[model samples]
Target chain A: MADFSYYIFCAMLLGGALVVLLSRGYVNAAMGMLCSMLGAAGLMVLMQCYFLAFVMVSVYAGSVLVLFVFVVMLIGDVKENSSIWRKIGIVGLWVVLGAFVGWVSPMLSQAAAGLSKTTEVVFLSQAKNYGLVLMTEFMLPFQIAGALLLAAMIGVMVVAKNPSRKKARRELV
Target chain B: MSYLINQTATCMPALLGTADCSYADMALFIVLKVVFALAAIIVIMCFAALSVVAERKVCAYIQGRYGPNRTAIPIIAAIPLVGNFLKKNGLMQLVADGLKFLLKEDPLPAHVSKLWYLAAPIMSLSPILICACLIPFGVWWDSGGAAHPLAAANIDVSLLAVLAIGALGVYGAIMAGWSSNSKFPYMGAIRASAQVISYELTMALAAMSVVLYMGSVSDSPLSLFEIASAQEQSWFFMTQPLAALLFIVALFAETNRLPFDMAESETDLVSGFHTEYGSFKFGLFFVGEYGHVALGSALFIILFLGAWNPLPYISYPESWGWISTLLGFITFLVKISAMIFFFIWVRWTLPRFRYDQVMALCWKCLMPLALANLVFYMAIAAI
Candidate 1:
């Protein structure tokens, strides 16, 4: 039953991604991405990472996708007509991706089968364990990520600010 | 994963099967969970329906008029004092309104996007139902004196689950507005998405403070059941008043209640996201809104009002068994009703905030306040 559910989630993830790739409408694409995120969260739950799963749903599917749709709605629906060459290129890319996956499948399956034999797998079931690891073991990396985010936010703020308007106000004053 | 499965299996072995838990028992467990989920959804839907009646009655009382007192079926209207009381309280209006929604023609506007227009109401309601399973409404004490939460799912990260699931409700509004293919709905959807996104930060931060406080006091701080149980001595509202205040304010915004109802402000947005939606679809949205309100109230009760506990510092007697459980459930129901009443009262009393004002309040005021509250709680925990 568990394996059946896992396969279902996998199908959902791949199907959603396919929908995202193929859908023409922006809202449809966003919804597809939401489905993909939910599938990924389900997989995380199967892996016993409940905290990570919920975070993925809340942050990515919930907030980020909402923002994506918000932007899409604000921009309005614009149908883009791609050249035939571009379509051919996408088909070629899909073939190459499928071939690559086919080539890697056996090794991936072998690794996954080996993983089942491992008795001791590190599991962060509780939220505290995640906090402990972030604070102690991964403190520097976490801090660096935070700093990077802050820097990006500052950059966006600077870019968004109307510098000419500020200068004009200063001159007027 | 095995641990989670085993934990669930052990939690309710009596309901599942024999003492020896097996694979088939897990299937039974899933069925039991589904039944519980359905029950929770029914309870929530009923509350939502009744709250509509309560809202009308409350609004009438506030405005000095009788609301829906005349709407009643003949059979029900023929009763003596009971019928008059029911009519006076506008209880039968619920039945009439429900029948209207059911019997009315569900119209699909020509201009609207067919798929999303149909999907939006279901999307709006499912998240609330999912979150409802996480709430520990009351505690059931067994013969051995051990207490089990009267909830559908007792997951460890229930608080996070609730927040995450609840946030997805924005999609419903967004979809409804966008699919409507009308300017009013589009504007309402935009406002809703922006408002939800803005207020979500404050809501998370405020809830985080409560989580932090619970962490210091309890074993499993992230679990809703544990959080409720931790408040056996005093509710979080007393200890973390600022956080509670921020949470309540954010809750109002999140649920799109009056004073923060930028989504469906009837004055400007022409009923907002559900502008093009009529009949049953509109009814679904209506019920979904109230469901969100009801669940939000239940969440507030669990977080700040001490869940099933009758009052602060007063714990239910473990020795009383089923009677204690009954009392706890009653207490929980009463608390939820009071919280719902408070929601309705505020809706009737307060005027809607301007769009820009709502945005400014969320980002400029509530966010900073929530952040400070979290920091203060962190400092207290550290000390």
Candidate 2:
């Protein structure tokens, strides 16, 4: 029963991701992105990463996708706004992801089968695991990501809301 | 690992007890518990609604105006033989109000995203139900006579899990307002986000103190039972009265009751986030509000009131027999009712706080007070 649900979820996920890549309409694409995110969260739950699944729902769905939708609306280029160039642009990335999932899933199951001996399901149970992993193993990358987000936020605020910059630019022009 | 297997094995007896066995069975067994938890809330909501009618009646009677007693219908009219004498003054006053809402057009203005507008109510309802699942209604016992937990989803991380689930209820309001594509919805959403997030901190901090204290109180075989048992001779509030007080206040605000009802300051924002909602969609927000009140009341009773204990008198696994369990369950329900009544009473007595005052009280009054309370508790624990 679990496996049946897993396969059905997988099908829906892939279909949604495919739609995200293929859909001409931005609305449809955004909807597809949400479906894919939801499917990923579902898979995390199935893998016994319940807390991570919930955090994914809370953070990605609640905050990140909300921002995404808000930005899409704010940008308001609402024509079935897919172009041939952008479609072709992501084919290599799609192929790579497809290849990775196809190869990794079997390897994961094989590894899981071997480790079925230990029998302790500690998958994503501890917040500290992700925190420690972020701080230690991926320290530089995480720091860099934080720096980038801060810089981007400042840049956006400056470009959009800085009155002096607008005056300075106007004077310069 | 064996524990999980053993639990699944034990569940066989439960599953075999009825083919129609369900979460509902577990849910029904908690009936007395739910009443204890929700009694005050049911009373308050009933009264809060009744007060709305009473306010109208009072206004009419005072001004020499005829109220709509003509439309009264008998819902199991209590008057003796003649059904007409027992006629309710459109006793379906609530029904009429309900039908008006149901038949009233759901005014989804062109500006709103239809999907989120529709999804908001469902979202509102889901988290409230999920929060209920973690509430310990009774107890679990093994065949060896060891006590087990009564909560549906008894994750070791249930304290934090319940908090997280409870927080999700805010999203429904947020989305309802933001997706509605109107100033009222937008303003309501902003108020909701600010209030929910603000009160959430104090609520969490207050709850966290207990969680931390629980760690100090017990190390292994640690259940909510332990938390209650730790208070066997004395409730936590006696030791941490300030924390308990902070918690209930936060609970009320967290549920968006009066005094913290800036989100639904209808005079200002027109039903706040749900101005556009009508029918069952509107009902979700309505019931969700009461549900939060119920859940908050339950948590308050559990944490501070020593759960189902009549006094902080009894201790040990042996003392918790079937009859005691039944009595404990009743005692718990009565506590919940008392808390809920207190909530309703407060609503009637106290007026709404202005948005600025609400924010100021939470940030300036509650937050600092919570920090100090935590430090005091920590100091005591250290000693």
Candidate 3:
């Protein structure tokens, strides 16, 4: 049953990606992206990453996709303006991907042959497990990344809130 | 992999009995669970319908108005005392209202996005319906001494999953408003998206505070059942009243109830996002909104109000088994009903907040308070 679900989710993910690439309407693309995210989350659930799956759905489909749709609606639906060359390029990229997958299959098997023989189901991605790892083993890197993000946010605000530029705009008005 | 196989094999019998079931039996059990879940959703829809009537009755009583108590069928009125009581009390109004919705014409407006316009109500309703499975109404201890939850989808990260599902409902309203191709609905949708997103932060944060508290208290994973069981000594509401208050307030906004119902403020936006919607589609939206309320209430009870516990700090014993489970179920239902009543009471009593004021309250007030609460709990936990 899990395998069946995995196959279904894989099909849905591919279908959604195709829809995103091929759909004319922006909202349709957003909806397709939503479907793709949901499919990905289902695959995560199949892997027992339940917390990650829920987080992906909540953050990506729930919030980020809503923002995407909101922006799409705000701008209104626009016809896809891709040239024939771009479409050809996208199709050619897919062909390349397929060829690369075929070529790498043997190499992947060779790499797998060198790996340790550990067969236990590792439920390492549960939220509690994640929290423990983040706060203990990866604490420094996590804090650094957080600080970097905070700095970036502050930089954006400072750039956007230039007093001189605002004064000039106010004067013009 | 073997665990997964074993789970699939034994899951049905774990809840039903100790019978070694075959594939068909397992399939039948799943089918039965799905049926039960659907039935539960229908019951929520019924609750929504009744809540509408109750709202009218409560509002009328408060304002000294008669409301819709006189809409009775003549034949039913001739069945003596019970009929007169039903007629006088507007018992059939729910039937009448349902029929009206069913019989009414659903006209698609010109120049509207037909697909999204039609899909909006379904999108709105689906999240809450799916989230209902995460709620554990009761926990029956079987003869084999294993506790079996009376829920459809029993996942470890159920709280997070439900919240995720709740957040998805905003799309339905946005889709409805934007697809309508009209000014009022457009504004309503925009407001709804903004409001829901903003309040969602506070809602999650407040719930996180509860989670942090539970984590510290019980040393268990952050599941709703774990949190409930942790409250055996004292409910989280008693310890974390501030978070509870923030959760309740944010829930009102999240469900788009009054005081934060900027999405559908009748005065300014002319019935808000559903202005273009009519008939059964509109009824679906209605059911969806009430489902959010009911689900939100259930979450509140589970998180802070001591879910399935008869009294505060007085949890049911596991040794009592089925009797305790039944009482737990009753306790859950009673808590949910009380919470629903509280929602209605607030809706009738308070005035709606202006859109700007609503945003300000969420971002400036509630968000900060929830963050502080989280930090405070974290500090205490660390200590």
Candidate 4:
């Protein structure tokens, strides 16, 4: 049952994320992105990295995709540029697909083999253990993530809020 | 290299004492770590709920209106095991506030497609959830006095995982604005993306200093634990204070918290991407933001603060015996809370930044600083 769910989640994650990457409509892409994020989180859970999985859900699906949709709204009618999608479609999409498949398969297989190698599973306890380590041992990265946030804060105000030099052009589709 | 450290750490107890410490058992520990993280999550969520009250009371105090003084109930927790004691105001103020959110109108404008609009908050909250897994709270906790694994999944590439997932929080803001099909939210989203992506590089490189130090130790590569344990007399902050400061600032920006919260500056963005959302869905985004804050604080605790070490100046505590692990866990919480409180204090004290200044700081200031910090770290580590 667990293996079955794992496969389903991985397929959805990869497929949904790719849909987001490839789709023209920002809304459709965001939707696909949302599903992919959830799927990714689920996969992380299956892989036993519960903390990373939850963070993926909290940060990506929760914040990033919302921002993407927001950008579309701000840009408005600028999105009608069918030529961009056509260009991507006409170009090396197959190559991107092939590369993705090539990378994911082996990692997934390794993770699968690693999981089967272990026994004595205590799922929730691992999350708790993660708490202890973050608190005690790996304290530096803990602090650095904070400084990163501050800089990012300053960056957003400058980049997103900085007005464009030229007139606001038409929105891209 | 991390694995070797983990093996040595685990086997130390059996090598010296009596418990059977095995890697397979350590793997089971991944699940155990996740359960303990619930306290951190619950603690912060409890505070964020209180933050709503804090925000309201402050607003009222400024306007001379009475606020939230009436909701205090007889302090008693009703739950089974630990809930027998009288609690604080029943801790129900947030619940009351949460109910209001649920009853409020959830309005999606006619111009927007309903599907994307409804999905924004959940989407926003989801990714931050995944990032928490790599964090190790306390070494393992059990009867056997063996060294325990800390995180749920301590993958070799957790730094990469953190960077990749932390980058995702931008989506929630972007999605909320775009799906609403509103003008202001959309603008908020675009600003958010540029701001977020720019700082990410600095964050990654700033982190690289430690990784470089650890990775470069050719004679004996330090696991995160060993590096953590190595600080007998000092935290890395003493040597890399500038980088530590830089990282904290970046973390605030990373989480879109106040002063740094340009993504949804109230004066201009008009609630930003989430303007169209209401009730629990909106609450999800709000809580998610706090969740980001909480996770960021936790990360700060682990990476630069010397993690579970009780004090930076003391090095190894004389009492750091089998009994001290429990105290280490408690002290860790206090540190995290202190950090979280700093976030709130900054939010209350500072005004929001103008978008231009925010961008200029990241590219011009932080990026350069981060690069310089990297060079310095490498130079010193090389010696």
Q: What is the DockQ of each candidate?
A: 0.52, 0.13, 0.43, 0.10
lDDT of 4 by residue, B56-137 (tens): 5565565687655455334434464334321333335666778888888866678876766776686677766766665556
- Chain A alone, TM-score per model: 0.80, 0.67, 0.74, 0.62
TM-score of decoy 3: 0.89
CAPRI accuracy category, model 3: acceptable
lDDT of 2 by residue, B104-183 (tens): 77666677778878988987777767767666655545557676555555544455556666776776877787678778
Docking class of 4: incorrect
List the RMSD of every prediction in angstroms.
3.7, 7.6, 4.2, 11.0
Candidate 3 backbone collisions, by pair: none
10 residues in a row with least lDDT, candidate 2 chain B: B12-21
Worst 10 residues of 2 chain A by lDDT: A121-130
lDDT (0-100) at residue B86 of candidate 1? Answer: 87
lDDT of each residue in B118-216, candidate 3, tens digit only: 999999999988888778777777666766666766677789999998898998999899889899999899888888888889999999988887676
Give DockQ: model 4.
Answer: 0.10
TM-score of 4: 0.67
Residue-level lDDT of model 1, residues B266-341, one tens digit each, is 9998899999988888888999999999999988888888999998999888888778888998899888889989
Which candidate wins on lDDT? 1
- Model 2 per-residue lDDT tens digits across residues A1-173: 35656776787678778878887656556657767877886777666565676677656654466556545544552656656777777666777899998999999998978866546644545444555566876799999999999999999877789598779999999
Q: Judged by lDDT relative to the true structure, which candidate is superior, 2 or 3?
A: 3
